[model samples]
Target: MMFNKLFSFFTVFLIGSSICFAQNANRLDSLVTVLENNKLPKNEKIQLLIKIAHNHTNTDEGMHYAKQSLQMAIEINDLVLQSQAWEEIGTIEQRLGNKNNALDAIFKALHIYDSLNLKDKQAASYMQIGGHHVGEKEYDPAIIYFQKAEKIYSEIEDDLYLAFVLTNLGEAYRFEGQLENATTSLTKALELNKSLKNDVVEGYALGNLGMVYAAESKFTKAKTFLTKAIAITNRLQGAYPTCVYIAALGSVYEKEGDFLLSESKYTEAFAMAKSAGLKEQIRDFSAVLTGFYEKHSDYKKALKFQKVYQQYQDSLVNRENIQKNEQLKADYEVSKRESEISILNITNANQKRWGIALISGFVILLFLAYLLYRGNREIKKSNQVLSDQKELISKREQEKALLLQELNHRVKNNLQMVSSLLNLQSRELTGHPAREAILSGKYRVEALSLVHRKLYQEGVDTKIPLKDYIQELVLGLFEGYNAEFEPNFSIADINIGIDVAIPLALIINEMVINSLKYAYDGIENPLLKIVIMQETKEDLHLQVIDNGIGFTKNDNEKNNSFGLKLITSLIEQLEGTMERINTKGTHWEMKIKLS
Candidate 1:
């Protein structure tokens, strides 16, 4: 159980059911003979060789056949066959404990898989690579590679392979101290394996979960899970998970202070590991046994198991050095082949030196002709694109203008309807003041409606020309009030935003109507001056002066009326200020800030 907590699991990606040819050597030999003599395509022959390679017991012999297959596949330019051969070589290297060589061979296959867009094959290769990283104690990189495999498997709907990857991923997470993630992945793997009826994988998942629980000090749950896992693995004849769970059960028992039960479990697991020929498990179980003996104060047994553990450790080191030497020889062979290729390239280059010079001169002439032709084509293409873009822009502008005209027409109609309603209501009223008020409202509505009518007639955009808008508004007001003389107009030639135009028109209507109604009631020459112009770089000014009766001393009482309040609110809304100059006549001046 301590092994699971501190060490990463070395997982094997089972691509398919393994051929039991190791126990049937005669059958394997027959296949190899058929491969050697058959008149098959180079690709098929290379595949047959790879099959024979997989059956070999000796790692070096397996690698030799794999290399032969690879060479034949390359000669035939069969990328899929080459990738298969490299994968076989990688498996053999991993079996021989040459991790770096194993990774190099696997990556070569992965490169081919990627170029061929073989998603399933790439996922399988990623799983194998991740397993090798886990064996090398690189948990972070191992988890990443395993996740890549998981994604592809899920996308391909390969649930069986996905479950296998999840089990391996859970072990990687456990070793990395991510217990929650480990539990979740392992639980999912367990459920998936159960659904697929893959008892072998299910056993491993359960055993791993048991170890994780033991690490978390959940002894009761750990014991129950390990017992079930050991029973399943033992029935299935899986020595791997059987030994792992047995040893983990021993640790749970030891943590619960049941020394006798712990010793029995460890001794049984050690025997199973020895019979399985699992050197790592053997080493782990022996170390656990040594600690178990020491915990019981049995010095003699502790010392004896300690010596056995050390021997296994030394054998592991010797095996590692042998793997390194094998890897170096492989690398040396690869380098020699590259050097031969380099020499062959140099010889070929020298033989073609004169031919290259002649070709180069012809290529230069051809390139110059191509450049001139391409330049002319590009210029024509650019001109066509410009013409098309200009036409498209013109069409869009026409559509926008039509839409604006429709909008203004609808608004003018709505305002006319409102004014008609007010006029009808005023005719029904008996009070003169009420009727007059309704007529004033009607005139104000007509003033706004005339502005919209002019805007649509001219087909302008969101800006209303101030001079045109004011002229139209004044003419409509004069017609509504039937003034004896038209109000003097002195407006500037400028454009204002649509938002400012509406409020400015309403203010003009109110001021002019007031002057017509009261300022010239009994006065002669009845001069009403309306002036609007830009006062400064940041201000626009409007003034209405009348040579008629000015505001009386009691004007404050009348200033609180609705019209005055409306004017005051509109000025505030425009963020402007107004002043009433009580000279010979009432002179109203307003300064509005330009945005």
Candidate 2:
């Protein structure tokens, strides 16, 4: 088992080769060169300097250099550089165990990048913030930041970065026992890697996929992918990320009841982490490896890893407490340095009086300055709140508009269905009278439908046009019927408002249906004419005449047919007077004054 976990120099070589192509520089020289280049694009130089600062170990000198770079970035008003600098500062602060400062700095950087729309920098900033949140076990916010970064990565079509972000997101999901989403995200990460041909990311994706599979007790497939990842890392010469790959693979081997293989891998990872100066990783690696050896009944090796884990844990606690003590001492020393002064007896009394007066003056000036500063801050906060609320209101309004459009869609569908049903009924009936009656009913529905349709077609926001309605009503009477059997339909001036046009259009449809069905059967040169005229601005007059059959008094009341009864009712709905004559063919006219 111990031998099975041994390092693959091939993996280490492969990983080392990939990073070797990156720009090389001495840390101090790189920082100085970037800082001295006053003409360089602000973002590029700052990013290069930050990369150098991040590679430095935790030390006062290293932190001082990192801070100097940040100050330069901020002084130039370079938002991109400012964001990158803060990220480096966060990395340094976190290494020094000032987690609060680290988190705050990274968050501030994230805010700056977000406002500037510097997406790649924003993603990096979010990833840093996520790292801190993960360290605190605040998984919810960690997941949020990771997802936001993933979205930006997707937008930029950076599949490699997207895969990495998804891996972390999957990790958070798995930690929360959301296995389904974890599997989905991790699987997508694998697909992305396949597209980019990035073997390193491919390995990571395989390892995470293995994690999900192992958790579900699919040992066989888990072993295959983890082993593939291990082999790939061997080709890379086992670079830093491979440390995580190995640690994860070891867990899969352990789950598969391969105790010896798991122990050997864990031991190799622990050694590599320490060699790489990843102390915290070594601690985490050893603790996990210890569990494997203990399960295998190797008490000595198990005890060794356990003892080392405890040693590291105790050392971290001691370091934190020591930092706290040092902070207190530093505070005391600063206070002491500030106040010590020398004076003689007579001079001391006068100095004390003068000091008191000076202090009072300074206090008043400070109070005034503080009030002005506070007032500005309050105003800024109020404006920000207002801006946020306005954005929320706009979002709600957009949602409301979408919902209203949907309603219009449904309404149009319903009315069209009603018209279709009436047409079908008209087609199935036999007698000329019955056919005319049903067809006429369908036309009335069509007219009503036209108004609803206009509402939909014009984006569901405008009123209907009376003149346009009459024109459509006249045209529809002749369409989709046999041309030889079609009527010579003509229109005159019409000024009917919506309320008048709606029912009046319905009546015309019925009268046209009647002429086409019975009056023009087996007859040549059939003509149906509709003329509408508004004698005054507030009044409309309409007439429908046909050179076909004439009407009787009984036909005027529709006493013999159901179709005529419906037409009479529709005419009443329009608040119009009706007249009919079949003499000299057929002549029909209606008049109405619309409000």
Best by lDDT: 1
List, residue by residue over 43-78, the lDDT tens digit for candidate 1. Answer: 778877787777665546767988999999899898
Clashes of each: 0, 23
Give the TM-score comparing model 1 with the true structure, all chains together. 0.47
Across 1-595, the per-residue lDDT of candidate 2 in tens digits comes to: 2211221111100010112212234644666666787787755665556655654433455567667767878878877667666766776665544556676676667666656677777776676667666655567887898888888888998776777778778766765567799899888888887767776666666766666676677878877877787677556444345676677677767766787787777778787777755545666777776656655655567667866766664454433343444454365445444434433566788976786676576878768767887999999999999999999998687556555555655566566657655654565565657886566667777778886666555553545555566667656766735546444434444433456656666677777777776676555677777777667776567777777756656655665576667668877776667787546777877776566
**Model 1 per-residue lDDT at 184:** 97
Worst 10 residues of 1 by lDDT: 14-23
TM-score of each: 0.47, 0.43
Residue-level error in angstroms, candidate 1, position 504: 94
Q: What local distance difference test score does each model get?
A: 0.77, 0.64
The superposed Cα distance between candidate 2 and the true structure at residue 376, in angstroms, equals 22
